[model samples]
Target: MREINNNEYHQWIKETKEIIDKFPERKKSFKTSSKIPVERLYLPSEITNSYLEKLNFPGEYPFTRGIQPTMYRGRLWSMRQYAGFSSAEESNKRYKYLLEQGQTGLSIAFDLPTQIGYDSDDPRAKGEVGKVGVAIDSLKDMEILFDAIPLDKVSTSMTINAPAAILLAMYIVVAEKQGVSADKLSGTIQNDILKEYIARGTYIFPPKPSMRLITDIFKYCSKNMPKWNTISISGYHIREAGSTAVQEIAFTIGNAIAYVESALETGLEIDEFAPRLAFFFNSHNNFFEEIAKFRAARRIWAKVMKERFNAKKKKSLQLRFHTQTAGSTLTAQQPDNNIVRVTLQALAAILGGTQSLHTNSRDEALALPTEESARIALRTQQIIAYESGVTDTVDPLGGSYYIEELTDRIEKEVEKYLQKIDELGGAVKAIEEGYIQREIHKAAYDYQQDIERKQQWIIGLNAFAIENEKMPEIHRVDPIVAQEQEQKLLELKATRDNYAVTSTLKALKEAAKTDKNLMPYIIDAVKVYATLGEITNVLRDVFGEYQPS
Candidate 1:
């Protein structure tokens, strides 16, 4: 395409106005949530000469268009619905139901006890077992959780942070029982501990030991579980915790740099572990901004890998991510309004070229989604993929003048943030100093002020709310779920070989003391049916817990 001359540019604008004068007059002013003004029409004159270079062909350098050449034309994005609740048997039934309904992948959500490394029978875990998600205490529960599902046939993602390694070990042992080799398994573990310290608050060990555990997984998976994503550096929680799109990617990139530096310090090659690296992000309401955010993130990560890290592999430069619609955007006042919010958010994710996606259910703000709501959520993804024509081309909005300009602006802002983080001695030191937390807090506070002042409207939440809005049916966990899970743990402890459990835990504790990788030892303990709490307790004794100052 050629740029228009100055005379032609002005003539085109005049002709556009003359044509629009025939229509009824109405107000056409609009602006994005980020305050970027909306222009009536875009012309080639508004774009820079180097615009083509920035929006290069898909599957090429920078990857502003997309990581893949064909994008969704070659394959549709995986529809992975995040679901887990009550007992393993109940969650398994939901998984089977979702798969039968055309969901392509599985994402597990662990209960509070499971995520914080406590067994169902623990005194501290009382009244919380299986309330939020599935409660998996040992291999027995893991086996039942994946009962009839073939591990090699589907990809799974586990949302566990502090005790991610133990949960992964249980998954590996589960595959082994199914005659599937570790190399044959493909999945992701949310093993990102940095975000936990910065936002989520699920961290267990202190900074140094936590990095060791993460890097250990990187090393072990690089050799044994080649198909597995060792860690999913997450920006989703940051956005949910109240960050602008720019801060979400910038802070996420800062953390990625820290992980790469740590791995290199351990004598690992950049390409060896970088290719298996994956990311998670949230797709929020701002439609065009969200699309531009994803585009800018890919380009920024590509340059960071090639220029900063000196990465040589093409796969190492690609920014493959899983996107979930923002849970914070769901409104409980008029629950049906959430479905429209999710639809728009899901469309933004699809246009942005996410590798996989999860659409939040309408009733999620109240409780776990019932089977009907969950099915509606999955159908949302299917409708966009099949019924909507947006997926027919790679980066359907790649060349729009507004989208390109927004993408460039977002990249520049994110670079400014990255530079500040570097000046503060990288992500870890900045996090330790509470710099990241303070920034997120300020953004969150400002957003809340906007809602209260009516500067922003959330439809049913602040603007269009009504009285006596009938509630939708919500899924509730049985009160007996905790008691049943606790009984199961007791039976397993009574039946398992206590001597082997003790022997493996002692070896694990000894390994934790030294610099040796703890994955193999952890895997050994998991094989003997050791509980999640018992294994984590051994490490807690050595590494100590993280007490936020």
Candidate 2:
């Protein structure tokens, strides 16, 4: 193989430009799934030399292709199907079923009440307990969550933001009870409050205190839970909320940077907590673009960690992440069509070299996934790994002229957003000023307009007319689930030592009042069976609620 000289490169660029310019008008109309038109064709000439340097070989400085040299060839991406609903017993059965069906990891989804620091019995939690996910009010619920699964063996991912610290503390306490040392625990917590403000809207305390809680997790995990990922800075919800690919990459990295800043402000070294930081992104229907986005994300993050944050460890600079197929992309009209959509999206994530993945169920557009639908989703990943032969080569699409060009183009576009964010005094300031939210809103509106005008056709929704089709009966949360959960919470309160609970909660309140890390205090309270509401209420009184400006 011979390397092309500058003159040869320029000649290829000139020829490519000519070909692009000669294309017909219809061909020139580049449209995304969101129906946003691309102004011009992206070419190798559009990429800069600096970008090429930044995106080196896989496993090298600035891991553009991937963090691992062999990627899936070494080990297939972990298939982690997110599941949790009703009670802990029900969720545990689901977990065992998933494990038996060949899921490689476990990802726990908590209910809205648990997410916002409320116990199942809280008056505010009425009608919501175990509705969206499992209700874990204390260590008892945590114990039931992992009943037969050995804590030291299975890696778990918990989706909880505002009360992340409390949940993480309970998890640790439970692991200890199971004879698993703190250092042996392996998992991740979605301790990303910034995205909660931007997209998810599950925040409890104000941003300042929230940041402190996040930093406390980082500090605690860095020392105690060595294998634990401190934060899953997520763009999954951002994309689900309808942000463009550029916005997803830009905003997610911006959030990660903000977390780093918060941890550093606590006087922690950059490499200390940075290595444990992981990302979560959405894999939408745009196959090549989604793949390019993940590649660009790794490259951009590696550069940021090394150059901006002065991170010394290779793991600190690497951008390892989990991908979830975009839930927003699923169509409810012909639910079966979603299976095809999910398969394609899952393939894109595998091609993008996600460290782990969760393929959304076809029924997700209507309600929580049924057992059969969840099995199909998990089987999608298994089929891709074993049957498709896509993993036979590392970065099979790596040297494709079109793919490389797209990857470089995406990196440049994300860089532009980063510069704009830097000018606005970082992500916190941008979020405070509502810049991120406004951008996402505009993108969402534009996509909606496309659907309205038929410019972008969702097969079942716009193009293919499926009239009078019998819709599947969607799963609705049982109204009695809340009452059952409430009774259990009340019984626990009656059985536990009320004075011990009060004392532990009082200590937690005192800890919250001071600058001390709340993790230790939280662990203490959880050990005494202090309810989630009591712990969160004390912190609420101290930190107060966040009213977006």
Clashes of each: 0, 0
Against the true structure, what is each candidate's TM-score? 0.96, 0.95
**How many clashing residue pairs, candidate 1?**
0
Q: For candidate 2, write residues 1-549 as lDDT tens digits.
A: 999999998999998888878876765364566332344666656556565575567788778878888888898898999999999988999999999999989999999999998888778888888889999988889999999899898999999999998899889989889899999999899999999889989999888999999998888888898999999999999998889998999999998888898899899999888889999999998888888889889988988998998899999999999999999989888999999999999999988889999999999999999999999999999999999999988778876556777777777788998988899999989998989999999999988898898877799898886889889977777778788887888899889998998998999889888999899999999998887888889899999999877
**How accurate locally is residue 278 in candidate 2, as Cα lDDT from 0 to 100?**
93
lDDT of 1 by residue, 300-358 (tens): 99999999999999999999999999999999899988999999999999899899999
Instruction: Please identify model 2 stretches exceeding 4 Å from their true place.
Output: 1-23, 27-30, 34-54
Q: Which residue pairs show backbone clashes in model 2?
A: none
Task: Name the best candidate (by lDDT).
Answer: 1
Deviation from native of the Cα of residue 310 in model 2, angstroms: 1.0
Candidate 2 local Cα displacement, residue 84, angstroms: 0.9
